[model samples]
Target: MKLAAATPAAAQVKADELGQIPVLMYHRIMVKPQQSLDRSTTELYDELTRLAKDGYVPITAAQFVSGRIDVPAGKHPVVLTFDDSTPGHFGLDAQGNPKPDTAVGVIERVAHENPGFRPVATFYLNKDLFGMDELQAAAGLKWLVQHGYEVANHTMSHPDLSHLTKDQVHKEISGMEDEIVKMTGAHTTTFAYPFGVAPHKPAWAEKLDGSYAFQGIFLAGWRPSVSPFDGKFDRWAIDRVRSEGKVKEDDCKQFCSTAWLDYLDKHPDERYTSDGDPNTVTFPNVLEDRLAKPYRAWARVY
Candidate 1:
C-alpha cells in the first residue's frame, strides 16, 4: 500500500496485524545448484511459482522496513532477497539472450503473470564481488536500480562484519556505500550483515545506524515484532527462510515444504540483528561455485 516511513498509524498497524513476514533468501538461480549450491534453478522458479499461486506478495526490503503493503488480515507477507552479485544470475536463453537473473527479472515476470500480486525485490551486492567488471558492473547496478530494485550493501568484499577491525568495518560499509552512490546515484541506506552475528554490544548496531540508513539484516527465519529477543531493531534486521533445491518436480514442493516452515518456527534465536564491534570476528573464505556453461563466455572479459 505504498506506506510512508514515519507514519505512526501505519507503523502501529504493521506491528499489530502482520504475522511473521517470511523473508525468503536465495543465492544463484541455476538449473543445477553448484556442488556447494543450495538451490538449483528449477527449485528457485518452483518456489516463486508456488508463492504466486499461494497469494504471496513479493515486497522489496524498502516495503518491509517502511511497513507499507499491509499484510491482508491473517496473511503472511514475504520479502524476496538475493545476495551476492553473481554472473550466473544473468540468466541466458537458448538462443543466447543475456537476461540478468537480477531480482528485476523475477519481479517483472511475477507482476505480469499475477496481476494482483505486486513483486519487489531486495538485491544485496558486495562492491568487490560483482560478476561483471567495473564499467559493466556499474551499468548493471544502474540497470537494477533503474528497474526499481533496492541495491543494498553486502560489504566491500562480503567479509563477516563481526570479524574485521573497526577500520576494516568502516571501509566495508562506507566504501560500498560510496561506490554504489557514485555508480548509481542512489545512497544505499540498507545493509545485510555479511554473516548473521548478534551484536555483542548495542553500540555496534548504533554505529551502523548512525553511519547509514541501515534498514535491516536478512538472516534466516520468521520473526513477529512483539516477542522479546524478537530481534526487531534488527526488525530492520529481517529474517528469511532459505529456499534452496531443485524447483522442478518435487523440488518446488521441497522449497516451500512444511518441514522448512517448521524449521523456521523452531529457531528464532538464529535470527541475528547485531553483535558489537563485529570487526573482532574472523571469517574464513569459502569458494562459491561459478557457472561453466559456454553461454557464460559472452559475459567474459576480453
Candidate 2:
C-alpha cells in the first residue's frame, strides 16, 4: 500500500506552534577587545556555525517584529543584532570591500560556506558609522541595506534615555533616523535602547511632528523573546540575549547565548519550528486562541 502525501494545509498544521525566537545580540566583533561587548572573530564564526548546524535561519528584526518569519520548514529562526556602529562591527577595507574580521565579513563568509545559511543581520547604528570616511560610510550603509541587512537606530550618541527630557529623547531617537536617511537614503523603523535603558514615557516610540517613529524597540535581555504571534508580545520592549564570552559584570542567566541555547535544548517543544513554507503560518492547536491578530487570520491550527 502506498502512503498519502501531506497536503499544504496539513503541512502547515504540522508546522504551526508558538516559537521562542532568540535575538542574539553582539557588540564589536574583533580580537582583543577593550570591553565585555567585544567578541572575538573565532567565537563569532563558531556561534554562526553552531546556529546553522542546528537549523537556525537568520531573519531581520523587522521581519521578526512583523510576525512574518519566512524561513524554510523545520528550521528555527534567529535574529542576529549587532549593536553600536564601531569599526569592528562593519567597515570597509582599502579595496572597498567588507573587512574579513568585521561582523559583516564573517557573516558573509559563513553564509557562503553554509549554503542555506543567510548572511543577514540587523546593525543598530549610531551617528558614527564604523568611523569611516563620510563618503565611504554612506556607500557602506547603502550596501548593507541593498544586501538584505537592516540598519536601525541606536540613538545618536548612545545616551541613557530614561533620564533625558522628552525633547532630548526625541533628539536621541529621531535625530539618528534623520541622519541615517541622509546617509543611506533609507529610513530606520526599529530602535534599540542604549545602555539597555528604556524611556519612562511612551512618547519615545511615538512620531510627533518632525520627529520619527519606531515600530519595534529592543532591550538587553538574558532570555529568548516570545513569538510575535503570541498574545504576550510587546513590540516596544522586545528582549535580546547577548552573544559574548564570560564576564564579571554580565548576568549570564538570561543574557548570554549558552544559557538560552541550553534552555531551548532542554525544552525542545518551546522552540519555534517553521513549516518550510513562507506563505502559510503554522502553530500548535493549543495556542489557537492566543494567536495575535496579524497571524490569527491565516495561521493553521495543528
Candidate 3:
C-alpha cells in the first residue's frame, strides 16, 4: 500500500521526517562473540527481530544517501551496513542459499518472519573480498547485487587512512573501485572509509580526480545520522552508530545501537518516522529551520 507523506493520518503516527535515522554498522557474524565487533548468529537474529517489531525497515546505504526511502507510512528506515566483507557476512551453500548463520542469512530469516521487513543491506568490500577466491568473490558480488544488496568500496587494504600518503590514499580508494569494475562491469557510487576514518585530506575519498566518485562517505561515529534533508547532513562524513550491546568501555554503554535505540523509543520524537512517502519531508513547523535549503520545497509541516 502506497502512502503519501502529508496524509492526514500521518498526525496519529507523529511523522518527523526531519529527525535522525540510525545507520547501524556491523563487522562480522560468528558462532561466538569473541570480539567486540563480532555478533553471534543468535544475537544478529534477535536484534533484527527487535528492529522489525519496533516498526523499522531495512534500506540500502545508497537509498539512504540518495533520499530514495519509501517504506510504509509510520515505519522508519534503518540502514544495515556490514563492513570488512568477512566470510561470515555472506555465502551460499549447496542449494545456493545464504548460509543460515551468516549476516545475510540472519537478515533473510528476520525479513521472512516479519511482513514489512525487507532483506536488504549494504556490504563494504575490502581487498580480501569476504575472504573468498576470485571466482567465488565474483559470484558473491553478482549474487548480492542481484538480490538487491549494495556493494560499496572499502579500500583495497583496510588501513587507517590517516597514516597513508596522498598517493597511497588514492590507490586504496581506486583499487577497490577497480575490483568492482573488473567483477561486475560496474562501479559503486558509494564508499565507506576504512576504519571509518578518512585521510587527512578527506576529499580524496569523496573523489579521485575523475577516475571515481561517491555520493556519500560514511564514518564510524557514535550516533544516528541527521536526515539527508536536514541542514546538518554531510555527504562526506555521515555518522554511523556501531551495532553492539551494552558496554561500559569506549562509551558504548550509551552510544551503541542497543542503547540509542532504547533512547529513541522512549523519546520517539527524536528519531525519523516515515510518512510512508519519499517525495516529501514531513515534520512539525518548529523544525522548519532544520530543513536543508535544497529540500525546502519538499518540506511539509503539520
Best by lDDT: 3
2 versus 3: better lDDT goes to: 3
Mark the 10 consecutive residues where model 1 has the least summed lDDT.
Answer: 280-289
How do the residues 192-258 of candidate 2 rate in per-residue lDDT, one tens digit apiece?
Answer: 8898788788655556566576788888877789888788889988989998644445777555897
lDDT of 1 by residue, 259-290 (tens): 45444346432221111111111011110012
TM-score of each: 0.66, 0.92, 0.96
Listed per candidate, the RMSD to the true structure in angstroms reads: 15.3, 3.9, 2.9
Rank order (by TM-score, best first):
3, 2, 1
For model 3, what is the alpha-carbon lDDT of residue 254?
A: 98
Pick out the ten consecutive residues of candidate 2 with the lowest summed lDDT: 1-10
- Model 3, range 1-302, lDDT digits (tens) per residue? 12224668666678898888999999988989788788899988988999999999999999999998888888989999999989999998888899898999999999999989999999999989877899989999999999999999999889999999999999988988999989988879789888787899988778877567899999999999999989999999999999888888678889999999999999899989988879888887778888888887787777
- C-alpha lDDT of candidate 2 relative to the true structure: 0.81
Candidate 3: clashing pairs of residues:
none
Q: Which of candidates 1 and 2 is the stronger one according to TM-score?
A: 2
